[model samples]
Target: MDSADANIATELETRLSIIDTIERDDPSRRELSGADLSLFIGVSVVIVLFGILVLAL
Candidate 1:
């Protein structure tokens, strides 16, 4: 019973660590600063405008 408990604890710890790593690495998990958010929006607008211009031509 002790061995089985140890094995379960180890497995749970491993899984939790992996999940923590994945969450840390995930881009969407991050909060965007105001400057970063502004830059992203600006770039998106520019790209959309460029696409429209190209389509018009």
Candidate 2:
């Protein structure tokens, strides 16, 4: 009912709208999924094992 509360509500709505717009429009939000993480972990493990083998020889 108060002007202060109304101002806060308006500001919040605006910020939320901006966040929605950004999430809807931004491409950087595109991300690798679980399969990518699994492949990365597998590759890292292989590299570490190869390094260990090289060091042991």
What's the residue-level lDDT of 55 in candidate 2? 100
Candidate 2 similarity to native, TM-score? 0.52
Can you write out model 2's per-residue Cα lDDT over 1-57, one digit (the tens) per residue?
Answer: 799999999999998898788776577666788998999999999999999999999
Give a tens-digit lDDT track for model 1, residues 1-57: 699999999999998897688777677667788999999999999999999999999
RMSD of 1: 6.4
The residue-level lDDT of candidate 1 at 6 comes to: 95
After superposition, candidate 2 runs with Cα above 4 Å error = 1-16
* Worst ten in a row by lDDT for model 1: 22-31
| Top model number, TM-score | 2
Backbone clash pairs for candidate 2 read none
Report lDDT per candidate: 0.90, 0.89
Clashes of each: 0, 0
